[model samples]
Target: MAHETDPVGDLTEAQAREELARLADLLDAANIAYHRDDAPKISDAEYDRLKRRNAEIEARFPALKRADSPSDTVGAAPAEGFAKVRHEIRMLSLSNVFEEEELVSFDQSVRRYLGLGADDPLAYTAEPKIDGLSLSLRYEKGALVQAATRGDGAVGENVTANARMIDDVPQRLNGAPEVIEVRGEVYMSHADFADLNARQTARGGKSFANPRNAAAGSLRQLDPEITRARPLRFFAYSWGALSEPLAETQSGAIKRLEALGFQTNPLTALCNGPDEMLAHYRRIEEQRATLGYDIDGVVYKVDDLEYQRRLGFRSTTPRWATAHKFPAELAWTRLEAIDIQVGRTGALSPVARLSPVTVGGVVVSNATLHNEDYIAGRDATGAPIRGGKDIRVGDWVQVYRAGDVIPKVADVDLDKRLEGAEPFDFPKTCPECGSDAIREAGDAVRRCSGGLVCPAQAVEKLKHFVSRAAFDIEGLGAKQVEQFYSDGWIKEPADIFTLAQRYGAGMQQLKNREGWGEKSAQKLFDAIDERRVIALERVIFSLGIRHVGEGVARLLARAYGSWDAFVAAVDAARDQGGEAWDGLIGIDGIGTVVATSLVSSFAQEAERASIDRLVRHLDIQEAERPRTEGSPVAGKTIVFTGTLERMTRAEAKAWAERLGAKVSGSVSARTDLLVAGPGAGSKESKARDLGVEILDEDGWFDLIEGA
Candidate 1:
């Protein structure tokens, strides 16, 4: 690229054309990485720089604008897996500028087009540009009709079925326009992402890279039921096209969306000028990391509808809006040391202790080095860095904190090595227990040979046994469990059931301990007693076996249906040899590692005895199967709508499902019946039009026999 000095600030046509093409290519590449890969090659600042450059080039060379330029585009090509749905109205992209000079230039262009001057200030609406997938939802007659993913601006993928699964996407509108097209972003909550990844890893599947990717992948699943299982949320940001005018201003349009039961982004702000826009951008950026979900930048749009129309668009993207991105959160820090820590599952991970540094507002001291290869910073270094090789005690290394939480060492600065800086020596024996630690073939984690005898692993197992999603002994939290372990009241999970028997007289002594009282001690005992008859799935999860999570435990419980059957299967699995174990592998959702872990856990005589002892005093309840008895809706597909007089929609669905019916969200030809309630709208009409059976609250009650 060449630069031309023009004192008069006029660009030559050829120069402008070249700049525009360069900017388009840059933005295209950035979009591909961000949207398709869930990874960005450039920082938000860099992307904004390139986008602003494109706008400047376009401004200077109006005639040289390309039809396919990102400056004139909405989003990248439609992602795979979804059925393409052509947007009723084109979803236009936004123009962008970075520096104050570029923003002023953009403002000047707007003013010039409107035949106004600098003194004629423009008002704008600024909102956080959520780092998520954009979607367009269409409603007909106050009912959700269609939902589409924002594909290449002109067209998108129809995802109505998947969209219906999203709880935040209202099925029916309240005070909605006759026909409205609301645009929003579907995002995954941080907690949801963590849980989803935990389940994924527990199933021996690769975890999603981030929440945005997880949300997109979940939404685009072939099975709508799979998408429904995910914790995906949607927030309306802007409008695509409307059959009827919603509101005069952009803010008003968002307000109307909220009125229609759509969840709008609450961080939107109305600003009177550029200064206020910048202020809002700064405020949003400052609180970005704390927001839970990711946001790359802030979007500023012209508030007035007339002004936006007057400013118009350039081929694809609208000139009425610009994105103000936050500065990059990436930083470099030295890796001080690498320490191996064993998890509850006995999997050891190398944690990098970094020199204290701030990245995206939060102070990060430690970064996960992943495994031995990560610690050694090489592939062939069989000797782990902590095991006396590769990365030394004094070596400069690069660190990164992606979304302000996960700290990771990115690279090593070998040139900054100091003389006599000894290579890290990983202990040959368990740090917490003096036992031979060996790494299994094809496994990076070095396991404690002591197994149940290792104090560290034992305590971790006990903690897992009483976790909230497991047996859930109410008064026996992690802290209390640790205290009881230290006090010799509990040695293992089985010891928990015997606490009252072993410490009945010692309970008075525990009452006098700090934070413990007579009532509290009694409460702990009662809680333990309450959990003596835990559900089969809870018992399976509470066993604290490696590679088994709540979902997997439920799957196992459902497969076996009883504690004796499950135990027998596990015992049989061990004797069946590799092929029989491989036969167990083909079971739905059960992978080789999980199957192997199941068999291996049972093979240990000590662990088996512990489990037997624990269950000796406790009763393992049989998992309850959903009843699909002789209800009218049983074996029928039903859709519930509006407010029910007898029960909440959730309760009604549960009851219907218990009777063996498939509950659908929308009324379709496949729908055997539609349970319409008060204020039912489009679903009622659709059912009536399609000749699908429609039952009112009273009629439904009479049919189900639960009225």
Candidate 2:
């Protein structure tokens, strides 16, 4: 780790430690303002100046280097919602150089490290640095086996189930390597994000802060089906551990990846020298904002594999590559006012009302308040703060918008607080229902105890019951549901099914109501009629119980097997406390909070009555039949790859499941069948290595059909 030009090499260990600590503090402050707050206090020029000074100090005092040094990191900590997955190979970050002089210096360093003279030409690859999450996908014999996020470089979250939903990520590869790891960026296209936010706003749901957050949220969803719905795309950029080496050059590796059916960024270009690299970066910078997807900067990597190996890497960053980030997008606006709102789950949220300002091309008027602690700046006694506080009535706040989407407040200038202004007091009761609100210990949210009695909570619950992810009563959109509830046409979820019956004569009158026409009213009625029969999983999720998301709903459906049995168990858990409920908590992955939510939701007399009435009007469909008997693949894990000639991939999967087979996306020792199609690549080879049975399309048809 030692270097000849280290500046801190001459300083004592104590002095080096002091300098390192100062660097950490400065970088941390910058990171909070830039990454978390979205408002950067310093200009890119000034920040780079400070960053270069720190780098010099770190280079001088290598002995005092900290494990989590800002200079060596790529991104912040992996988000909290997803389960952590340790990376098979560390996803080290890249260093950064902003100016052309630094780029030339970087090129010279690469040549010098490789023992190349000035006359010896050097080449590099340049690609747009995607403003998205970094991920690693592992393939054994060409079949995707594991996918993980770039957490702390050393560790990441296991998003294998969700990754399977990305269409670009082939389940199997062609012309497979024995073992390969592909690294890429996961992002949502600009158009898709816009559409998604539009739908969210129309439904009265909170829109995503930006494309990056939307992509992150969608990818981490528990349900594979939900992830599949999001328009997420991937662009393979690098590699990790491999059983056999790739091509001799970085450009060659990318070409090979493209041949293997990976989607590589078409913008990648090979540069002969630092000057060429700078030229390419400048070209990309000129078209940055109009590129459709967000690009924070350009990434440059040495083309020669040998040179990259020779340069090696630091603990968390490669010596062969660097990210040349674009300048920050910033703006200023007036803070008009602050408003507090409640959520479906009863959490009180503060929202900032602002004078319309454009950042990254989108006009923004509001920003999140996070919580009550962020507003008053003190506890009940006006003590000094420890955590975030709510924004006051007239505080000047910095705003930032990225990727032409939602704007967020970056920082508040308390010095500019209006004269004689008083700290805003948070409501102690639910605004809509007057119920006592409780801020649970260890939780940041304050929730209403009124449950179904609260109008806001009730309306939100009814909306969830008929949401697209739930029972999916097509014509029962959020606005329609709200109006129905307010008009007493629907009082509970069960009331939805009996609406036509209860208001048989009034149905004609609905056309006369505000926002309702004859065609719309008829469409609503037809939609309600169409959903009289629902699958078990949908019914479970549509119940609007807390923590019962799509994944949990499916798990419950499978475990209970029938609606009656599921209802019985839920009722039993409510009646016979402790052990009965603890048994639910004992199920791996189902925690106390979820178990309690389920039991509490069903325990209420009103909720039970609604369920009963709904069941009376609706027909609960039987679960799909399991895979056929005496089949060799029955109860065994199967992975399908490539394009199928006999049927669509979805159709093939449905047929397989109907016959009692357990299908998975990746190859493992447990895999019994690999039904590979025409272009079957990696998965087929991985199956060979694992000694799993490999079936061609005809062979699969023969086995399933008993031919």
Candidate 3:
């Protein structure tokens, strides 16, 4: 545990104490931002470095370990929106290893703890450690009962409704125990993330930083409909509370979960020893980008369930498992120029064009500058960054791409900078359309006021309209959209639907075009024809209305049921303070901002004309609805309170939902029924005062006996 050349190792007792306190505050803030807000202020490498330094200091001076030490915490406390769920079995984290030697030492420590020789055989299961939100799904009697997030290890947030919306999460298990809590990571694929960002930009919505943030934000949405619209997926890798033994080994348990209708990682393999584990880690890292999803590292766990039990856990992390994190990759590069790209939303995005340099194998020649504040070496709040060193056009900068698809400037090499280098001056006007680019108060982006007149914004919006999550016309990608736009073949979404009608006279016009022959032109026409009968949600999303991404589109679609109904509602809602306006804002995920944006899209004369013309050429289907027609309690809100003698709260809620009943956490005037248990309190009194139907445990069971 000694490091002769380390700065932390050289710290005095007093210095170590002060450093620990500072590190404690920094780590606490980072955890809250990452876990609660779904926004990380620092990189994973930086967080790991700080944690390692704190641990080293704590080891050097044990007595100096502060009461609020980072080692004692797992995730941050659950945010206030959702009801708290106390985990039956604590969801412990895993220790980390960033080097092969450290992984070897970890194996040695496990062997020493188990009283085994280094030569003795030890099996471990290695799988990709997903860079996403941790969730625990509880099943009761072969039915999915509840889902919770990993909040502060011992407690979590109830996300049962959102979990049910995820396609990967099985609603019911065919053959499983009476009770089981399956743990896994909820992640978004790279393609989905890109598509989501495209839709966000098209609609002038807030875009996520990365796939991890996108997945977290999508899955944690208040409305289940929003979560359902998101392309969120899960990979079951571990388990918590189990009614019976799943399997004798870790790999076997994963297979069992897969067999019982769960998606487990395909790369999860049983390694004979640490060498094999590290080999698997290397293999996984090599195929990282190609894997489609985000994985920060490889997790290795004791294969034998009995061995894991014997090894047990430390304060917050498990002793039997370790995460082999990918090393941070950085490289020095020259800043050739700073280019400003206008997005579909008219946001002026700054791009740093760098001299080609390889960071972590891939050759990176461009990196994101984020916004004006970032280029000026300050954050949104005017906080200093990179020691407040502003970037210049011609300067030596350090670029980092550690496992991220996007490369970014991490630091500036001041010593290597050119003598005459000057600070970058961000543009005040739209570079594409010569429009007034204004930065509104409290907004991070400077946007073009030219609206649809801006060619860049118009072309980008057209591209997004045909994106995978939108209209999804095959052979009509970004390149085709750009080509068609430049050639004046298509200028808007409605123009795409009429391409065949306007230019399909013998197909000669399109066939003779560059990159197009008779077959290719015909294929494009067929693709457009195929997309003419899209679903209502897809049609709504294709419009690229502000703040209306796939999630909002789905919510709006479900609320109105059909395109005509949706249009009618929008027309009726034109008058402020009307019932239609109130109803639009009443949707769970449709806040004031989103509702206002949606209404504005319809209010604008030009936008409404474009939408009407588009609707004329397409067959928009009715929104899909859940099957609740014949259920007795369909649409009735019910509340359960106190200690139930017959079933757990999760079981009761699941049962009620299965019967098509809506379950609420508290008893309000809107509550139709209240199921009171032995220790019912304020809720029961409120229910009585409201004259809502009351049912005891036996009465509730009797009411739903034959349902």
* Predictions: Cα RMSD each: 21.3, 21.3, 21.2
Q: Which model, 1 or 3, shows the larger lDDT? A: 3
**Who wins the TM-score comparison?**
3
* Per-residue C-alpha lDDT of model 2 across residues 1-707, encoded as one tens digit per residue: 21223355565667667666776777777755543333455544455656676677777767667886777764445556667777777888777786778888888888788888877988899999987667799999878999988866777778999999998899999786889999999988777888888988998887876677677777777777888888998989899988887799999999998998999988899998877888898778655544667776799998989888889997667889998876555444567777767666766677888754434534356876666765655454446453444456776666765554456676666666788766777888988888998987766668888877888887888888889888788778898888888888887887887666666565677778877777777777788888888888899898878788976776577556788877877777885466666666665447777887888878778877777888887788766545446766667678999789979988887677666676788999989889988767677778999899888899888776761
At residue 450, candidate 2 shows an lDDT of 84
What C-alpha lDDT values do all the predictions have?
A: 0.76, 0.76, 0.86
Q: Which pairs, if any, clash in model 3?
A: none
lDDT of 1 at 625: 57
- The TM-score that candidate 2 achieves is 0.47
Scored by lDDT, model 1 comes in at 0.76
TM for candidate 3 is 0.51
Residue-level lDDT tens digits of model 3 in 1-707: 12223487577887787788888999999999998889888877778888988898889899998889998989999998999999999998889998899999999999998998989999999999888899999999998989999999999999999999999999999889999999999998877887888899888899877788898999888888988888999999989999999999998899999999999999998898878998999788666645777777899998988999999989988889999987657656678999999988889999999865445534466999999999899999999999998999888787878765689888886876798888888999999999999998988999998878899999989988999999889999999999999989898899998999999888999998877999999999999999889899898887777688977887788778898888888778777578988998887568777877777878988778888888888888998653466666767899999889989998998678667677889988889999999868778878999999999999999888777
Question: Given candidate 3, what's the lDDT at residue 421?
Answer: 86
TM-score (all chains, Cα) for each model: 0.47, 0.47, 0.51
Q: Write down the lDDT that model 2 would get.
A: 0.76
Residue range 1-707, candidate 1, lDDT tens digits = 23423221455677677767767788898887765555566655566657666766766667777887666656677667767888877887666555666666766777788887778867788898876788889988888989988777777778899999999999988777788888989998767887998899888887876677788888777799999999999999888667778889999988888887888888999987777777787777555545667676788888889988888877776778887655555545566777888766666677888655445434455788776665665554454343333565556665566554577776665666787887666767777777887888888677778888887888898888888989888888889888988888788888888777777676877688888888998888899899888789899998888889976787677667789988877787786566456556765558878988988888889988888888888788887654545566656889999889889998998677667677889988989999888878777878999999888999988887751
- Deviation in Å, model 2, residue 562 alpha carbon: 1.3
Shift of residue 342 alpha carbon in model 2, Å: 2.5
- Cα error of candidate 2 at position 566, Å: 0.5
